[model samples]
Target: MTSETALPTPASPLDLGETLTFERDGAIGILTLDRAAKRNALDDATITRLGEFFAAVPEGIRAVVLTTAGEHFCAGLDLSEMTDRDAVSGLHHSRRWHATMNAIAESAIPVIAVLQGAVIGGGLELASAAHLRVAEDSAYFALPEGKRGLFVGGGASVRVPRLIGLTRVQDMMLTGRSFDAVDAETIGLVNYRVPAGAGTAKARELAAAIASNSEVTNYAITQALPRIVESGRDEGYMMESLMAAVAQSSTEAKALMRDFLDGTGPKVRK
Candidate 1:
């Protein structure tokens, strides 16, 4: 797939200016944080652009890769915008982030995050929303909300805990501890760790492989796996069985099975 497909530029009536870049690589949608001067720190405008980009993702897209064009993936939210905010205002502000991030998480296509350099605070929260995460050697993860006398305003308090243990997250916040890519992978924060500068390519390759799957299978995998994990074993098994029956009964699945039996499908190779 060509990597130069044009995507809609961020254009809002409010005109917050473009702090994000959206592009399409064949069936893969690419969203890049463009605020390099601030280490891609998400300000109100950036957040708005992010919401707009994800909300309007093209229907033809099959998957998405979230990355940034900078040494740092993201340093977190712009605290400059947080000054003098009252309780009601703070809750709404945080809710805005939740809405934006949830759009990414709940998109029709799965999202893969490509991380490098500093991924801290709200940055980590964003990455956690993706279905898969690939971190480069240069990437580091941290949660410094405690040091800033603030709590996690993004969905980190919920999503991140599902990745790494609550204790590890608390330690990162409480003691300002940082974890490198390898450690992050070990702790389940990232699915893969590759050499620096290779994260986006790797993520694209992964997304491409995922895009080749049957649409129904991909949809079920993305939508049902998380719910199954959250359910009790008995209920989860019932749901899994139901999904399995539905998936295998698809015409695509039957065609694939016929190809395999007819020796038309590619043989397994190491």
Candidate 2:
């Protein structure tokens, strides 16, 4: 797991509405899937709620820790909602999922998914949307859409591939293959792997560190960096230099630099 400092419980929970709960601990927000009965499977209401909530993440929350109740993190979309939909409706549904996933990924604040058992189908897509993922030993990932005679609707087709690569995603989808936490980590699906039930704590720790970052730095990473990667080499370098100038010009940057130069700030250490 990534190194992080521990924090106490949040002061109070925020009212983010049903199917989920929200709490703020300093600059970090804890967004939890509260649907244990369905193993946190996301129906339309839940998915819409998830998107809406994150799209307007509280100003006080600079980073997020996404977790769920029960053993399983999410079983994917509530397949029960698959009843009676024409091809056009299905297309719209898929697009809706795409929008939901995109909202999370596009947020300026970093999101960290705390993954546990049964991270499958749309569950995997949801995890992929996170900037970082912490997987517990009990966590297992899969793409069972093939067996269900359906293709992935969420942005997994695009985002997951970027993380674990297209070939591996193809292999998993084609064979309905499942990967454990360690394997997921090795494949780049998860940033950190921890013992069972330790995912949330570790993820929150990461969130705390992320929250401590300068606002401009975090915004650049969440916004400019990904776009820069997709640009041509010359364009990417130009973008990087522009961002570097803006970042260094910040008052926060000046203060931090002074601290480092004066030996007040923490130094790099193994």
Candidate 3:
């Protein structure tokens, strides 16, 4: 891990302004949504900044923890940003959101979201984009777009369904139902759940653990695993085999294996 003074410059300038705050804790990059006045509601600028941040994550950052200020992680999109538009314009707008969410979901390093309070509508969609989520006990998720006579504009229709299943997402959208953190964990919406104030700590712990992994293995787990799972069985097997071979070929992987055999590597523990 590089020291803060020695960190590489970002690929793009991270002048995301006050709505988003970016910092580094060793190898872990932390991004916090800071629009508490709007319950950290996302707007065009915020979403665009998110895309930029992920697109140009500083070199050597192995993982990210996405959290927010105030009580709520997010209450969804800023309704004030809503504008009437024709079908063509609306389609383009939605596509922009899809692109941003895709950037998060497909980032090279893992992203862990710390969820608390309301995770509604676009907020739920946003959390779904993270590779892993740690929800506070106070967290509650909902898709209220349906109640507002609108469907999800983000990648929720695809990503959320993939996490929790089509039926569950369908139910949430159709009825504007809200699920608490426990229920969310039960349905696999979140990977971890903790006390309200402990979310960030837990997420940091997870990010640290993720940062300790070999980059090649992490890449295979984050990048190849999802595609392999989505592929046809034969194709999936082939992809997995290829990824396995590639990962094992890395010098870091070989060194780690040598350490394991030499009794110098960390062992799996509960």
Evaluate residue 122 in candidate 2 and report its C-alpha lDDT on the 0 to 100 scale.
91
- Which candidate number maximizes TM-score? 3
List where candidate 1 sits over 4 angstroms from the true fold. 1-17, 266-270
For model 3 the local lDDT of residue 34 reads 95
lDDT of 2 by residue, 1-270 (tens): 111111112233243458888878999988999889998898987777777776778887899999999999999999898878889788878877877787789898899999999999999999999999999999999999999899999888899889989999999999989999999999899999999978888998899888877888998999999999899999999999999999999988888899999999868889
Candidate 3 minimal-lDDT segment of 10 residues: 1-10
The TM-score that candidate 1 achieves is: 0.89
- Model 3 stretches astray by more than 4 angstroms: 1-11
Cα displacement (angstroms), candidate 1, residue 34, comes to: 0.4
lDDT of each: 0.84, 0.86, 0.88
TM-score of each: 0.89, 0.93, 0.94
Better of 1 and 2 by TM-score: 2
Q: Encode model 3's per-residue lDDT on 107-209: one tens digit a residue.
A: 8989999999999988998999999999999999999998898989988899898898999999999988999999999999999999979999999999999
The per-prediction tally of clashing pairs is 0, 0, 0
Error of 1 at 129 (Å): 0.5
